[model samples]
Target: MRSLPVYVASVEAEGDRDETLRELVTTDDPDLAEKPIVENFTTEALGTGLRSLRYTQTEEDRTIVAGVRYAWRSQEAGCDVVVIAAAPDPRRILGAMDDIDAFVEQITLTVSSG
Candidate 1:
């Protein structure tokens, strides 16, 4: 069996939540194969969010990479949290969707009372 690379990253940003989420999925790179598949979703920890799946061709080797990004805004915290999962093979990304969903679902943000 062949092994593929998988990547997961998360970031928290303080700014316009909607705009932050939009920026997370937007790319001006010309290497993209086509427009990404974007959709809106609601999560238990976060109220409303966006999920985007995009494919891009590497400039060096021209290999295709599939990246899935999930962005959620914390109204109480006044910030947005974005999570990204990517793999060299699109099938690998698809296979990890469920695990990614569960990981995102378990995220809980805490705000200080001060």
Candidate 2:
């Protein structure tokens, strides 16, 4: 059996929207193997966003953890939505990218106007 770890969250946006999106796609963690690979992404529900690939090496076990992060700023909701998919094996994460992307595409955000 195989498992993929995923996290999804939404937070209030602060400062500039573009800056917030940029920050979400960028990481400066020391455990990272190298600079993350980031790309522009557009989702059906969230609109334009960013995606990043990161590999972090664990110090205790010396294992590489592969992660993919997707971030989008919801103008209607005035918040940022982030989805992260991670796996111990890099190949697992890579192989599941398509499914993960599809899942992201299905996300929907709604805001009511007064």
Candidate 3:
């Protein structure tokens, strides 16, 4: 776990969740533009009030790995929560690319309305 070289964090923001997620997925920044996209998806059925997206990329040298996950807390307030992570080559967390869904399902979120 500690040796995986992975990073993870969460952010809460107010906006059109879907639109924000689209922007992140379609970023035009030159540096990121060159990184290959490994996966992208959205869903409302995974967990309670969760509308989410997952994106992953690997550097050409294969020395770096990065991923982003976006989840909308609900359809009621346009609230959005995003989780992001990065690490050195070939994620060792789940061992295989096919295990991503299982890895994602392990993520838990708590949303509080103010």
Candidate 4:
């Protein structure tokens, strides 16, 4: 859940998905550490809280498909979903959203003091 927000922010800031991915590779988070470096993904969720993933990276069979799936799911909780695979750089990840722009802008909307 936390990783979803972090992933989006990191990719948006770095502008190079590959580099950001490299950053993810070096992260301390257990989940990010286990993500598979594969080109494809498969996801399965059981009983709402159990999500399992299996994908093939060139080196290891274990992968981070779970986090990716979670991130996609997070958007539905209150956001628009955007999925990107094989982003060599963050900038390569086009179509990034304002992420509930209306919600954000509403914060600035003022009311009469009367």
In TM-score terms, which candidate is top? 2
For model 4, the superposed segments whose C-alpha errors exceed 4 Å read 1-11, 15-17, 22-28, 32-37, 40-65, 69-114
Q: Write the per-residue lDDT of candidate 2 for residues 1-114, one digit (tens) a residue.
A: 487867889999888877787677666657789899888889878998999999998889989989999999987798999999888899999999998999899899878787
lDDT of 3 at 89: 40
TM-score of each: 0.81, 0.90, 0.47, 0.19
Worst 10 residues of 4 by lDDT: 45-54
Candidates ranked by lDDT: 2, 1, 3, 4
Better by lDDT, candidate 3 or 2: 2
Model 3 Cα lDDT, one tens digit per residue, 1-114: 454332333445556754665554444334452543434444434343222222344456534344443343444433444444444444553353334444555655554667
Q: Which RMSD values do the candidates have, in order?
A: 2.8, 1.6, 5.5, 15.4
Candidate 2 structure, TM-score to reference: 0.90
Model 1 C-alpha lDDT per residue in residues 40-102, reported as the tens digit of each score: 867887878888888998888989999888888777776677777777788988787787777
Query: On a 0 to 1 TM-score scale, where does candidate 4 land against the true structure?
Result: 0.19
Error of 2 at 42 (Å): 0.5
Better of 2 and 4 by TM-score: 2
Assess each prediction's global lDDT (C-alpha) against the native. 0.75, 0.87, 0.43, 0.27
Q: Which ranges in model 1 have alpha carbons more than 4 Å from their true place? A: 1-16, 27-29
Ranking by TM-score: 2, 1, 3, 4
Candidate 3 colliding pairs: none
